[model samples]
Structures are given as structure tokens and as C-alpha cells.
Target: MAEKSGKAFDFKLFRRLISYTNPYRFTFYFVALSAILLSAFAVLRPLLLQKTIDESFIPKDEKLIVFYISLILGVLLLEVIFQFLFIYFANWLGQEVIRDVRVKLFDHMLGFKKQYYDQSAVGRLVTRAVSDIETIASIFSQGLFMIISDLLKMVVILCFMLYYSWQLTLIVLAVLPFIVFATRVFQKKMKTAFEEVRTQVSNLNSFVQERITGMKIVQLFTREEIEYASFKEINEKHKKGWIKTVWYNSIFFPIAEMSSSITIGLIVWYGGLRAAQGDVITLGVVIAFIELSQMLFRPLRQIADKFNTLQMGMVAANRVFAVLDTHSKINDSGKIELQNIQGNIDFEDVLFSYIEGEEVLKGISFSVNAGETVAIVGATGAGKSTIINLLNRFYEINGGIISIDKKRIDTIDLKSLRSHIAVVLQDVFLFADTIFNNITLNDPTITEDQVVKAAREIGIHDFICSLPGGYHYNVKERGVMLSSGQRQLISFLRAYVSNPGILVLDEATSSVDSHSEQLIQDATDKITEGRTSIVIAHRLATIKNADKIIVMDSGKIVEQGNHNELLEVENGYYKNLYDVQFAEVRDV
Candidate 1:
């Protein structure tokens, strides 16, 4: 994790992050321009104070005092107004840069082939999008202003201080090397502290997210206490990291106070003598030195705090940069577009495995004719889903090819390829929105009529109408407001609405009740009427009417024929499995 954050704070990452704000350089300059004028105006106030103390107040000149006081008030008022606009623009620039980076990252994530998501967690991506991006945003907004204003103020004040008295300026300068050294030491420690904090926070976030997602499981197994304890551990780890930062800052502040006071004392004791001994120094010059000390040390305190802030931003950068640096596992050489396609799919001795040396689909070869309804049957873990995954290019085959109408899928553009196919998964996932959005999934061209027609075909439109708000009613996340059967119908509607050339129903009806199953079957027949459909079914009844039923075992096709043909092969693996399911259906 240190390595990860180390990369985040890298100069190159900041340069890239800075480049995003480059487009708004004029606005940044306006802020800087205002700051320069404001700082100039700011430094003049102390000089005005010195004049009032020595010339106006002591000599009892009321008019001069009033004049100086009015000027001071006017400068303060004007600077505040410009400073307001400057800060507003700076904040806007920061947010805009964040928006740009987030947009670019999301677009890139979408371009990454499906395989990348298969290997990564949603939690990490969530952190990158929210927390990590916010870090860079802060650096751009608040950090940039502090950096620019402090630097400019430091340079200007130092120059003025030197012009006043070279001897006194040198004394202030002597304290700086120690101040910078102390800051440098704390900076290294703070960086480690902040990086650890970020890491622990991510872990805690992941843990809480997991528990919330699996709340039912935790309750069912009576592990809520266990999970809570586990969560507390992670959360406390995060707190410890943050506490370390607070502890160090507490120590550093007193040290800063001591150093600053010592410098001021050195001035009062040493510079006072020169004033008393008839040197060129006046009460005004000594007073100016005292005022200058405040300017010098306040920025020094800010400088110390700014280092801590930089470390925090750098910690955030590490995670964000890591994600941006990731290269997608899949890429296309040239664009391939398909206007129309006949749904003839062929698998030529395809070999695939999720894990090395453990082949899931070993040299499995098959062919489906145009408009064929092929039922792929298998016992659990017999590579049925693996086969479905291959057709859609979810995972590339280690050997052989998946071709549609004899055109290789690898050569086809992913968008074009997926556009021709749709799958209804076993775990039906729906958006937390209206039924309209859930069915359409934000496809702009899909009309309301299409949504109704698709839902109607899947036998859920009437059920939706019966709900209080019907289709406009909230769907809730994962369609939790509805039954398992209703969710299945929604998933089915998604598949049918696509009007895809190739349809895959991977346990699509597994969770549906019998009545809903029959309705889904009717809709399935309608949708797959002129297209090829691949059904991965465990239910014996659903696959009975398929044009072909192929039994899979240990990643190889053990038997192939229609349902009756497989039943007739009494001596095969098909016979025993058929007897068990056949008996259960009759019992039901």
C-alpha cells in the first residue's frame, strides 16, 4: 500500500492532474492576479499602523489618524470582495478538473473489455470514483490557492524585511532552516500516516459494504456480532492512522510556537538596544520588525499545515493513478461493424479454463443452425455457464474459435458483437429506478411502447399495472420490491426488448414459479422465433421442446439429440439423470 501511495504522490501524476486545470488557466491567473493585488494591499496596512503609532497618535494629530484608519478599512473591504471572486473561481476550476478526470476515467472503464471487470471488485472502483477523485479535486482547489498565495506572500515579505534591516532579516532567516527541517521530518512521517489512513479506510469501506450486501446471510447464520466485531477492527485501524496525524500536529504546533516566540524575543531584546543607543532605528522601524515577524511566522504555520495537506492529496493520488494506469486486457485492432447477421454459431474444438491447468471446457465442439433452439444441459460445474460465457466473448478461449455465421467473434468490434446478443442471467439484476428505466437500461431510443410490449410479452406488464404506481413505481435495487418470479420476468423483458439475433437464457427461469415459468416460456418462444436461443436449464420441463438437447459432463459433450432421443439412450448418463428429474416433476 505504501508503494501504491508512493506512486500517487509522484511528480508525474501531479503534472498530469495539473494538465486538466490547464484549460482554465485564464481563470486561475485571474485568481492569482487578484491575490497579488490583495497581498500588496495587505502588506501596506502594517506600514499604515506604524505611521499612526509614531507620527499621528503620539503627536496627538486626530486628522492624520482618521485618514490612515479609513485607508486601512477601505483596503480590507476591497480585498475581501476580489478575494471572494478569486476563491469562487478557484473552487470552480477544481470541481471542473475533477469532472473532466472522472468523465475520462469512466469512458476508459467502459472501453475496457468485459474481462477486466471479471477480475476486479466494484468496491475498489467505487473508492477510485468517489474518495480518490475527491483528493485530487481538493489539491486543485484549496491547495493551489494556498500554494500560490503563501509563496508570493513569502517572497514579497522577505524582500521587504531585508530592505528594512539586513542584520534583523538575517536573524529571522537563521530560524528558517530549522523550521524547514522540522517540517521535512514531519512531512515524511505525515505522508506515511496519511497513506496508512487511506489504506485502512478503503479496507473498512470494503468490509462495511460486504456486510451490508450480505446482511441477510449474516442474520441467517447468527454472525451479526462476529461481522460487527470484524468491522470494528478495520474501523479502529483506520482511526489509529488518523490519530497518528493529530498526535504529530499537536507536537509540531508547540514546537512552532516556541521557535516563533524565540525569534520575536531575539528581535525585541537585540533591536531595542540599537533603538536606545541612538542608532538610525526608530520606534516605527522596531514596530515594523514586530509586525513583519507576524507575517513571517503565520505563513510558516501554514507552510507546515500545507505539507500535511499535500501528503493527504498524494495518498489519494496513489490510488487514482493506479486505476488510470491499468491497461485493459482486451483491445481491438480495427473497427468491425455488422449491419445484419444470421444466427449460425459454431464452436470449433474450443478449450477454456478460468484457472490454469484446470480446463473447464476441453476441446468442446458444436454447431447451431440458424434459428435453432439449443438446450445445453449439464450437472453443476460441468462448464455450462463457461460455454455461454465463451459465445459472448466474456472470457477468451484458450484454443479454437467462436464464430457467428462463420465470422470470428474476436475480429468483430465488442459493441457490435454484444449488440447482436442478449442474456438473461440467473441472478436478475435491475436498476433502482422506474420500471421504464429498468427495462430500457437508459437506452435513449427505446420508447415507452417498446418497454410495455416487452414487459407484456414476458407476462409481467399486468402485474406491474396492479402495483400502486405500476411501471412508474420504484423498482428498487435488484428488483427487491418484487418476487423472484417478477425479477425473472423483468430480466426476460430485457432480453426480448433487445430483439437480439442470439439469445442466451442462463438459468433464466430457474427461480420463477410454475405459472410464471409457463408465461416466460411462451414469451421465450415468441422472442426466439426467428433467432437462435441457447438455454442453460436445470429444469427438465423447459428444455424438453428444444430442437437439440446436448448433455454436458466434465466439460465434454456426452450425449446429443432431442429430449426424446436422449431419453431413449437408456444406457447413457442421460438416462439416470432423466429418471431422477422425471420422478420429481411427477411428485410436484
Candidate 2:
């Protein structure tokens, strides 16, 4: 999470963000040049208006009047052209920069270890990747370049005002210090307000996402009203955040308008007195000073608003950079390629923990030879699932050497190693796409024919065809359209299509019905035949045919043997566990 800074502008962060625009350097430079040209043309219009009044109208020269009018029109036309270029190029640069930043942010997230996600909310990450990045785009499109253009126009206008009458210019600028002081106060207050708004937006997104995802639980527990009340509170906070920004704007803009009016009044009063004295000031000069004063003070007011946009963008950049700067990436230093891996897995004195000082796998040693089936049975929280996680290197181990085919696992390339391993977890996840896509996961090489063949081999082809559209059916989000048993079968088909050398089934059959269980068992036998398999068994009968059974208690292996051999022990943990946990299944 990013903390809000009290500084009005984070120049260091601004510089870092500007570096991303290097790729579109040409467009950025063009926009900057357009701003300069716009200022020049804008200032020319007022000077032309002053001259037309003083030289052409007073002397009543029609031809001169026509020439001055044409020149003023040309300046206006040039200003319009430059304005168009500025808007187009600035927006183009913003879009290009944000596209690159979004890709970089997503790629960085992909490299983060599972522990990072374990403690983070998915909605918060989504907000940073989507909404916050959009806010940063305003920095270029509406904030930075616009601020520069306004400032340049003000400077040019001030120079012209002084050229006309230094005394009148001083009179016009008397109230400017008060306006600048007010603007500083507005910037500081609005920065804090914008930060609060962003935080509230993230909280609102997280709350809504979680509630929708867990709607089943909420309904089952009859928590609709309670959840709605909580949401109302969050929504109220979000509303309040925006209202704070509105309140500040309301207070500051009125003050700015009052200051502008007062400056114009002071100039008119003093200039009128000077003209009355002895033609020291002209009528045209007084009118031009009014125009110049508006140009100067107007941007001061707008600069406050644009500065708010820039401040919000900086806050978003800070949050995004915080995610990029995280050092919790898993080490992928392995250079070895395990082509045609034999699937001989060995865990030597492995010690692990998901949290500090709370060891989950304590000095555990185990091995599964090539083409062997190993079943691990344990009570809940006996670290059965932890083994699967460690095998796939999802979490780093504290102390251990896990090897494949007598080669250290860490020495193998991360992608290549995971390519040869398949895991079918108890809670299977499927995308909201076609069944064919769910099975093949849109792998270009794995064609529709290949997926159908894999499904048929696993005896799920007929079951799939029974559904409307067969493989083309949309499963909706998270495969909600499918039953629990059907989803498990789809997961099996997905694993089988991959043809992995090592297969891990972590309670894969624990949540299915009897018919789905039969389908899964048939698929399991076919897929695990020629590969090394590790089964985290919940039901003892599921592992009765295994080559070896390892019973675990409190992160340590208590017994290791085949079913009959283990049952022969008088008071063995497996024997007692079987009687207590699986005797009813056996009778049924």
C-alpha cells in the first residue's frame, strides 16, 4: 500500500514517471512546441486589438482598419491551429505512456511470489492496474501541458502589460499576491483530499468485489441486509471524499473571481485619474490592461485546478511504483533444461513455513521413484497440501534440497520445470470461456481435436457432448454453469491434455459425487499410469491401490507402507484413522 506524502509535488516521482514518455519523445516535444506557439499567437491577439483601437479607429482610416482586422484574424487562426496540435499530441503521448506502464505493472505482478498475493486483496491490485493508471494519463493530457501553456501565456501577457504602462501594470498586480497565497493553500488542502478519494475508491472496489465473489456464502448465512449496510457505509465514504474536493473548489474559485474583479477595478480607477491629469494614459491602453490582467489572473485560478490533477496523478504513480519496487520475487536462477525429465522427485530434510516461526513441514524427507504412485494421508492441517505447494515452488522452503532426476530442482529453468508438472487442486478454477478453451487453455498447439481426444480418453467426451454446444459451451465466470463434479472432470481433462511427467492430485476427488468420482477415478488411472503421481488423499479407500502410503501427523511422517501392511499394525495411526474416518465409506 502507498502512503500519502504531505509534499505538494513529488518532483522525484514526477521525473521517474516522465521517463516513460521517452518512447514517445517526438510527440511530447511537438506538444511542448505547440504550447509555446499557442502562447505567442495568444499574446499577439490582444496587442493587435489595442493597435486597431488606437491607430485605425481614432484616425478613421478604413484601409488601415481592414489591414489590422486581417492581421488579428490571422493570429486567431494560428492560435486555433496550435491549440489543435497541443490537444492531439498531448493525448496521444498520454495514451502511449499509460499502455506501456499497464503492461509493465502486470508483468511485475506475474513475477510476485504467492506469499505476496496471500496477504493482498485482488480488488486492490485491480484498482491500481486499471483505475489508478487512467488517472495518471490526465497528468499529460489535462494537467502538465495545460499548466505549461497557461503559465507561458501569463508570462507573455505580463510583459505586454508592462510595455504599455508600468504604473498601470503595477496597479493591476496589486491583488496578485493575495491570489497566489490563496492558490498555495488550495493546492495543499486538495492534495490531501485527492489522496483520501483514491483510498476510498480502492476500499469501495475491494468491498464490492469480495461481496460479489462470496455471494453464495452471504446468501446461505442470510447476510444480505448486513452486507448492504456495510456497503452503504463504504459508499458514503466515497461520496464524502469527492464532496471534500468540491467544497475546496467552491471556496477557492469564488475568492479567485473576487480578486480578478478587484484588480480590474483598481486599474480602471488609477488609469482614469492619470488620463484626466494630461493624456498620460490612452483609452486603448486601459482596455488592453484589463484584458492582460484577466489572462494573468485566470490561469492562476486554473493552475490550482490543474495542479490538483497533477497531484492525483502523482499519488497514483507513487502507489504503482510501490508495487514495482517489491522485492518478494521468487529466485529463478536455474539455467538447466530438464528435457524428457524422468520424474524422480526427492525431498531431503525439507523444512518450510508459510509464516515466520511457524514451521509447517518440519524436517520432512520423502522420495517418489520414476513411474511410482505415492499417497499421503493426514488429518487436516497436517501439511499435506503444503507438500504440493513446495513441489511446484509456489513458496520458498526454509531448509531443504528438492531434486528431480538426481538434479537439483532450483538448477532447472522455472518455466521448463513447471511445464513437466501438472497439479489438480481440490478447488478447481476455470475461465469464463468455451469448454474447449477451458480444456486447452487456448494453447495454440493444443488444437480442438487434441482436447476432444483427451476428453474421450478420460471418458468425459460423452458427458461433455450431453451439454448444449458441447465443447463450445460457455462456462461463465469461474465455471459457475457447471456442477462441482463436472468442474473436477474438466480439470482432469485439462491436466491430461498437458501430458506432464509428474502429476499431483491434492484431494482432487474429495468434493465430487459418486458418479463423478467414478469418472475421475477412471481418468486418474489412465493419466497416472506412466507418470510419477503424488496423491494427497482425504478418503483412505482412494489410496488403497497405491504402491506406497505415507501417513503424516503434525508435519512429520508417522508411518510408510502399503494398505494391508499398514493395517496389520495393532495401534498404528493409519489403522486408527481408517477406522475412525473411512469405515463408513467402506461399508457403503
Model 2 lDDT per residue over 1-588, tens place: 444567999887898899999978888989998988888887787788888888889788899999999999988888888888899889889889999999999999998899999999988999999999999999999999989988999899888888889898888777888999999999999999999999999999999999999999999999999999999999999999999999999999999999899988888898877766757587777777888888888888889889999999998999888888777888999999878988999999999998899999999998899999999999999999998888888888899899999988888888888999999989999999999999888889998888888888889999999999999999999999999999999999999999999999989999999999999999999999989999988889889999889999999999999999999999999999989877676677
Candidate achieving the largest lDDT: 2
TM-score, every prediction: 0.95, 0.98
Best by TM-score: 2
Off by over 4 Å in 1: 1-9, 586-588
CA lDDT for candidate 1 = 0.81
Residue range with the least summed lDDT across 10 consecutive positions in model 1: 1-10
- Model 2 scores a C-alpha lDDT of 0.90
Q: CA lDDT of each candidate?
A: 0.81, 0.90
Residues 248-331, candidate 1: write the lDDT tens digits: 899888888888888888888878898899786666767887888778777777866875676677667667767777777455
